[model samples]
Target chain A: MSITFKLDVLKPHQPNSPTLARALKQIEGVKYVNIRVEEIDQKTTSIIIFIRGNEGLLLDKIVEVLDGNNCALHSVDEVTIQDD
Target chain B: MSITFKLDVLKPHQPNSPTLARALKQIEGVKYVNIRVEEIDQKTTSIIIFIRGNEGLLLDKIVEVLDGNNCALHSVDEVTIQDD
Candidate 1:
């Protein structure tokens, strides 16, 4: 089974800064990561990360990675898996 | 691939009034619906809906359901599929 989460990340000191991409990749059990950047409050950039992992282990891995990163849990929603 | 969206609802006049839920189910092409509610700003409710459907048809169905509900698009994330 798979679970998906939407991450609202603080603006990277630099756009495309690898801090998030790298941190997420380091989280054990995260099978895939797709990050999109958005700006809210005009000053803070929100990094939206899409992730998939073992249903039993995904949230712990995600929370670990998000610790101390100024990240917020926007939402977590389950989805149908696409083979693509 | 499946796509999922997070919605920020502007607090229904009544919680669990079923307007949002029924409106969502009315949208064609939504295969599965799971809605979780959150409250922010002490008044507004944020709805997190999880759905499964044709990979190509999910978003349009969701958007149509969300139309004119004082809703805001929070984020859309993807995930791996689980047969369960």
Candidate 2:
């Protein structure tokens, strides 16, 4: 199955969107990742992330990566799954 | 060049998201399109549309199709262009 996720995340400035995107893309089944900044504050940046991947995508793993980058997973806004 | 656009749009329920996506895909040079509904009111649905295409994509044509389907283009949130 193919899965698509829309997530709300808050991150520190260091890794940045491109760096985060690259990290997400390196995951096992991820095909595409897009991160759009929604808000920027002194300490953190809020982003809307869209990820397209296969069933191998694990929410826990995604959260792990975000945690490693000093980011917070605000919410999993939407999830769509399609069978192959 | 490859272009990616994030747009805010409002549309009536008739055509639906999948239908609108199909219509947009038919436009010349379009490669990918994704529409996520953000809000739904009594009369309209607000959506965030992400479109990835080549340089041939014309904003006017996109607007024309949306107009024909009784949709309104609220705002263009972001635009990214990458040179090949």
Candidate 3:
């Protein structure tokens, strides 16, 4: 069975770094790792990552990757264009 | 007012293409463009592009850009891990 997870990340200072990519694939549950560059301010390339994986394991791996990379993930905002 | 638009794209075969990057910035309503490399399959590097722009104009420009780039975006899934 396959499942998808929303994983948005910010790469403000490192857009071409493959280090994060390598670490993400090391996780056990991650099936796909999609990266989207969302915002750039001053010197940051904010990005979003979409992944497919087992829920618990994916979250665990996220934590591990964040720790290893010394980066932090953002809380997803459930902002739907609700009334139109 | 400022807003964020989720624009996920698949760059199946070209991860280093800067043309898309350049084209995206030309849209009038676009506030920012972020890219994330989500998956790598054989000869493709699937990526996501997150953007912020005026609702109507953004959609219009997206269509124009897609027409120019020959890419299609997928319907965003409202797949929440509903019950956990």
Candidate 4:
């Protein structure tokens, strides 16, 4: 069983997008991460992130990771679950 | 100003420690991550992780990342803040 979801995130403009992507991929069961920048300003960048994993995604964990990265989760846009 | 901390984490035995190390390093301001195995069983592995960052480290974000990786945080052992 696995699941996928889209998240809207806001992060500071330092660490860069690729770093965030790599960080997210380290999550257990997380197989893929696609992050697209939607908006950027002097302080922060808004991104749309899609994550797919082999099981139920942990929302709290995701938030914790983002907070550590100096990022914020705005909303969960979409989700899909597949049982295997 | 920067801060460093040590975390005790328990995770499933699939994703290697290096992966977790890489993930933690991606957090903004995080300059280094050291993860050592404390114990391992058939189902999970216990690890001690140290993270150093350029500023105050966000505990919430670390937890989120851990959760996504299917890991649980047991305790935070040490902390140091350096102002530069």
Please tell me which predicted candidate would have the highest TM-score against the true structure: 2
Tens digits of per-residue lDDT for model 4, A12-73: 87566656766776777777666666777779888887877777568777887788799999
Q: Tell me the deviation in Å of residue A42 in model 1.
A: 8.3
**What is the DockQ (computed on Cα atoms) for candidate 2?**
0.04
lDDT tens readout by residue for model 1, A1-84: 444455545653444436777777667666778877666555556667776654344454676666546565554423322222
- Per-residue error for A44 in candidate 1, Å, reads 3.8
Candidate 1 ranges with C-alpha deviation above 4 Å: A14-17, A40-43, A58-60, A70-84, B1-84
User: How would you order the candidates by TM-score, starting with the best?
Assistant: 2, 4, 1, 3
Fnat of each prediction, in sequence = 0.00, 0.00, 0.00, 0.00
How far residue B63's Cα lies from its native spot in candidate 1, in Å, is 24
> What is the clash count for each candidate, in the order shown?
1, 0, 18, 9
Report lDDT (Cα) of residue B15, candidate 3.
Answer: 26
Across residues B1-84, which tens digit of lDDT does each residue of candidate 3 receive?
233445555564642646776678678866677767787778656667766554334354665785577656652211111111
Q: Which docking band does candidate 4 fall into? A: incorrect
Backbone clashes in model 1, listed as residue pairs: A81-B81
Better of 1 and 2 by TM-score: 2
How accurate locally is residue B65 in candidate 3, as Cα lDDT from 0 to 100?
81
- Per-residue accuracy of model 3 over A1-84 as CA lDDT, tens digit each: 545656555554542323454456457755445455566567655656555555445465675676567556775432121121
Tens-digit lDDT string for candidate 2 (A24-66):
7677787777778787788888888887788989888899988
Which residue runs does candidate 3 get wrong by more than 4 Å?
A15-17, A77-84, B1-84
Predicted complexes: DockQ each: 0.07, 0.04, 0.04, 0.02
Best-matching candidate per DockQ: 1
